[model samples]
Target: MKFAIAVFSPAHAPSSRRALLFAQAALAGGHEIVRLFFYQDGVHSASANVVAPQDELDVAGQWRSFITEHQLDAVVCIAAALRRGVLNAEEAQRYQRPAVNLPAPWELSGLGQLHEGAQSADRLMCFGGD
Candidate 1:
């Protein structure tokens, strides 16, 4: 089955970990992931600046590695990312920001990307938020 996963929580949140695990499992099971959309605080997962505690699992790093290794379509909501100070190089330059926390393997897009992903996928699994 093809799936589109939407995450609305930060990397530290349990739901974020669950979402990562779900995606990994799906891929392992030979299921395709059309897209992984990160909205709201979930954009933190795509931030290169995020540094998990030494004792922690570093869910964000795991996400980065997983997405990179599989060449997954990982999209972060631009609006939400901007609102939370998660800026890509282009966005940081446009906004005159000094730093870029979002890197390659993660694209900053709009909600339309999420909608398109959902429309193309057989299932839309949303995690976190309320």
Candidate 2:
């Protein structure tokens, strides 16, 4: 089956961890993930500046590695990212920001990408929502 996953929780949240585990299980089961949409606070998972404590798991790094290893399409909502101060190189330059926190393999896009993912995938699984 083809799946589209959308995560709405922060990187430190349990829901985010659950989402990652679920993705791994799905892949192990021979399922395909069409896209992973990081919405709202979930965009934090794509931030390269994230620094986890020594005892805590590096959720952002885990996400980056998993996405890259699987060659998955990971998209973060541009508006949400901007609102939460997560900027990529182009966005940082355009906004005159001193630094860019979001890294590669995670593209900053619009909600239209989420819609497209939903349309293209056989299932759309959403994790963490208020």
Candidate 3:
């Protein structure tokens, strides 16, 4: 089955870890992931500055690796990211920020990507959010 995942929790949240694990398991089971959309606080999962303790799982790193390894379409919501201070190179320069925390393989786009993912995929699964 084809799936589109929308994650709305912060990287430190258990829901974020569960979302990653669910994606991994789906891939392992031979399912196709059309896209992974990070919205709201979930954009933190794509931040390069995320650092977890030694005893805990590095959720952001794991997400990065998984998405890159699978060559998955991972998107971080541009508006949400900007509002939360998550910036890419172009965005950082445009906003006159000193640094860029979001990196490669994860694109920053509008909510239209999420809409497209939902419209195209067989299932649109959402994790976290109120």
Compared with the true structure, what per-residue lDDT tens digits does model 3 show for residues 1-130? Answer: 9999999998899999999999999999999999999999999989999989999999999999999999999999999999999999999999999989998988999999999999999999999953
Write down the TM-score of every candidate: 0.97, 0.97, 0.97
lDDT of 1 at 77: 99
Q: Candidate 1 has what TM-score? A: 0.97
All candidates: CA RMSD in angstroms? 1.0, 1.1, 1.1
For every model shown, the clashing-pair count is: 0, 0, 0
RMSD of 1: 1.0
lDDT, candidate 2, 7-42, per-residue tens: 999888888989999999999999999999999999
| CA displacement after TM-score superposition, residue 28 of candidate 3 (Å) | 0.6
Candidate 3, run of 10 with poorest lDDT: 121-130
lDDT, each prediction? 0.95, 0.94, 0.95
Q: Estimate the TM-score for candidate 2.
A: 0.97
lDDT measured at residue 106 in model 1 versus the true structure, 0 to 100: 93
